[model samples]
Target: MTRRASATISTQPSVTDAPLRYRLIHDQLKNAIALGKIAPGLVLLEGPVARVFGTSRVPVRKAFEMLHAGGLLHTFEGRGYVVASPDGSAPPPLRAPLSESALGFDEAHAPLALPSNSERIYHAMEAAVSIGITFGHFRIDESEAAEAFGVSRGTVREALSRLRDLGLVEKSAYSHWLCGPLTARAVAHDYELRVLLEPAALRASMPHLSKEKLTLALAEVERAIDEPDSIDADALERIETALHVECLSQAPNKKLLGMIGHAHMPLTVNHAFYNAFNLHPEAGTLVEHRAVLKHLLAGSTEAAVTALADHLHAGQKRTLQRLKVLAVLPEPDLPVFMHRIS
Candidate 1:
């Protein structure tokens, strides 16, 4: 039995967040080499450079490739990549833009939230899959995705498998990955499962629910529902996680928690609803959330379960109604890494 913690939901993804350590390293290295700090013809060892970037050799190798491609570095005869002269003169350290923070040091922050290259690829693929499904059914070509993301076929498959585990993707008989055409029926069906599983998880977590934590979560919901113009991305994430992820963390069953983790209606629907209507979770949703939390804090498991059911039912109702409008919206522009095979 593993005690779960707050759900590690990915933030609203932009292309900027998509995994690209190599690109980031490459760009920084380009700037460094161009400014002559590395010195022309000095060897760039993979191990030392990787340690500096707080990453392994893989992304650093990728970075080297980009630098080699851009003529800032060169490969010796089966030896190593050495810095190449940008021009006849060594460049001074060019000042970074005032808008940029000088925190390239690994301890302070990373260029991305995901730590590993594979994790970054996973997020990038998830975003691509989500937008693809919203538009229509599409067969994801594994090899093509590998080529597109500049990763191996294994990495592409691994990322796809994670998405499949999330219930946002599926494999066809021919071993091809398929994603959806989001519809009224599918949305309602998903909510049906949520109504049962989520509340049970909450009930299971009752013993672990803390007064302070529940109070904080309940307060977040109140602020979002009661405050004017509280429909920003973080507010939605806070309220949604407070109910769906944080409360469910109290469940001791690892398998149950894993199953609940895959159901991302809070992230998906709430994000889409906000995009379409410029609104957060509707007022009634907050009231139901508050009621469930209030009951749980009071040790009334039965009341919490009932209120949770009503909350999910209402969410399902509203979600289905909004699907029509979302269905008509244009497909988002996605990266080459995801090849949508209709």
Candidate 2:
């Protein structure tokens, strides 16, 4: 039988963090092992851990290297690393799931320190490339991207590697990085997967959704309804995180989360739709979000699940409509990193 990781995957940030994906994975594994969910002497495999993070094995391997360096794991000459048992008398602090940590914030207090510069650059590139791709297909130019972002060639490459993992970008026959014009088939496939996965996650999430968190998430919806003019990629992520990822954070299964993240193409596709059409998120979206929250607040898990499903259905409809609008748009004004291919 395959061993599943404990629900507490411990993706929390460490103090004095040097920003890198591998380092974050390393910390999470360390925390998990210390908490005893991952038993001592259990062989840690890279493939499973990489899937949990929705990333590639390259980072996971690097994380293992660091874990071994820190004496958290022991390596045999032939076999892979083993989780070194901690001192019996003292165990490390157990970390809570993300929903527990994120439940009580309002607009008054700012969110945690934003990701590092390279991290921020990664998201920026994704948004620009997504919007540009929606307008029309484009081949990416590594040098041009570096110059446009004012970052080094290495930084752009790192960002591009992440994009490739997300299935949002691809390499072409001519050895160029090609970004979308996301196809209708791709959109349909994503919806099918979400319909299967998200409701199950929402059902599993009810016990974890605190009133404080529900209220906070509800308030954000209301605010967005009142001020939906600036629904950029980051803003969209905030809304989705509050509704989707946060609610699902408590679910015992980490692989479900990974599958959802890997196939969650609509987030970018819908953002691109809005940008290409030059419109704000629909008012109906706010109402839909409210309905889901109201159901959750009233302690109706099934109803909440239904409302969430309806919201997804509505989003699918709007995405189709927006696709029609995007169909006629010209090649968008894009950063130099993108070269028109079609």
Candidate 3:
């Protein structure tokens, strides 16, 4: 996700106008990572990188430092920095069921209500993380983050604090916040929670769900499948949420609706998983989603649940395959548990 600049450029010449040389370098390195040209766990050297970029050590140092603060690169005692491993080992292999313990937000603390300034910073961070724009490769400087959000540095800090509590962000050795990398384990855990909650909610609402509502929901899912490339992160999110929530909303049970609503962030994380794994043409995850929607609209809750479960399991397989090709992890040991679902 490209960060949309809210502030207009000033006519006056300033450091901001000069296009921070380090930012250019940062973007280049980021593009390389995304392209898999530089695999994760590869170390980066400041002196060598600076020489390659035809710049002095200062900007290169700043760029690596920034990446380190974002959790993309990790610092060693004397080896400079290495691309951080996604799971602190190898990334999880495909077809791996998420560990049961990995599901909920870090229970270390609760999210607090945000003030206006904090809210702005939070929104900016959320937008970046959701669309894989940042991917733990850049730090938001307190003053810069404040300026970006039109708030005070203190408010930005407050927002960062909240994100930290949620495990969405972590503090670096440099006292900067490094947004954590999205992991498959985390994604699968959220999907499990959704599977548990959403079907029940939809079932409760079946008696009250109007034909028009069901039709519209199925249409949205179909549209998403038809135009996967055209869909933005936000649109993808909406379509995924509607598939679950449209029917769930008709439930007479307010408590169930509230629970589903509370799972919104987790749902977003789960959607991100699909975004990452669906990179392969063979996955056809959108088609699988459409299949689940078809079953749901046919008033076949059991079939929908079975289809949804298979869809998720297939995702695990595809993601693992991609990761192996990228050499992030070895071929997975296909588990017997997945067969039980079938």
Candidate 4:
């Protein structure tokens, strides 16, 4: 057998102590963007960037390349790169606040529209989760996403970056990305966090949850439960998230509500596990949710809390069991972190 070539090694002195030149450049430019020093849509030329950084073109070029890859910079055939904008213009105008009228259905009977970013991000997230659950953990490159979404690479990148920020996807050391193969421990831990946070949220806002909001939430849940096909796991996941979010929205604590909102990924991933294992039938879930809803409607906070806790624990147990059967998760010990609904 032919011997493998000796591994090549760099001869340069270790620059471990020195500031990473490219990272510095990256931060500086990012700050400029954030501070509006370079306005949106302004072109960033490598030669000019090098001169500004007082360095050779190599590092600046590399930095620009990195930014471009990150979707913060847009590249064209002849014009080099410019700041990427989601809409390619000034940001869209703000919409009116959500109102009772706004919550009403159209003649065609679709649910009222949510914000564009919310809708787009939600759909993209569902697709990402579905792909992850079915295919195992896999990295999605920008080009693949661009084609998949029928949008520009910049839009896809922007979405991916958002997902990354949400902890739904993580970038690998080798530049690959992974969605989920979410360990059971991680799932249990996330649910524990949710349980600790969500019930308290519902209790705090139970008085504020208006009839309109309840109606909207109930409709969403019913729609999800009534879906004809079992394989539409994405729809089921969305409906599930919507139900929990609707409950949390009743809480008047904006900060706490925001935290609950951010908990969606873990919730979605956990539910995906539930779907994979068929832990509970639709009728079973409907019965559980109905019990919780009845307690809430009756203003029985303690009863609602108990019901919600039991429901969440059931889900956690099912997920953990499935993980064990798959041989992909370790057996959890006593006093294991469980999703607490405080």
**Highest TM-score model number:** 1
Tens-digit lDDT string for candidate 3 (267-338): 444444344344312326667777777877787877876776676566555544433332343222221111
Ranked by lDDT, the better of candidates 1 and 2 is 2
Each model's lDDT comes to 0.68, 0.70, 0.55, 0.57
Show where candidate 2 strays beyond 4 Å: 1-115, 172-176, 226-237, 272-278
Regions more than 4 Å wrong, model 3: 1-123, 130-144, 153-178, 226-229, 250-283, 316-342
RMSD of 4: 18.2
lDDT of 3: 0.55
lDDT of 2 by residue, 238-257 (tens): 77778877888788788897
Best by lDDT: 2
Instruction: Estimate the overall C-alpha local distance difference test score of candidate 4.
Output: 0.57
- TM-score: model 1 vs. ground truth: 0.66
TM-score of each: 0.66, 0.61, 0.45, 0.50
Q: What is the C-alpha lDDT profile of model 1 across 165-235, one tens digit per residue?
A: 87778999989888887666777767767877988898899899888999898777777667736556457
Q: Least lDDT summed over 10 consecutive residues: which range in candidate 1?
A: 1-10
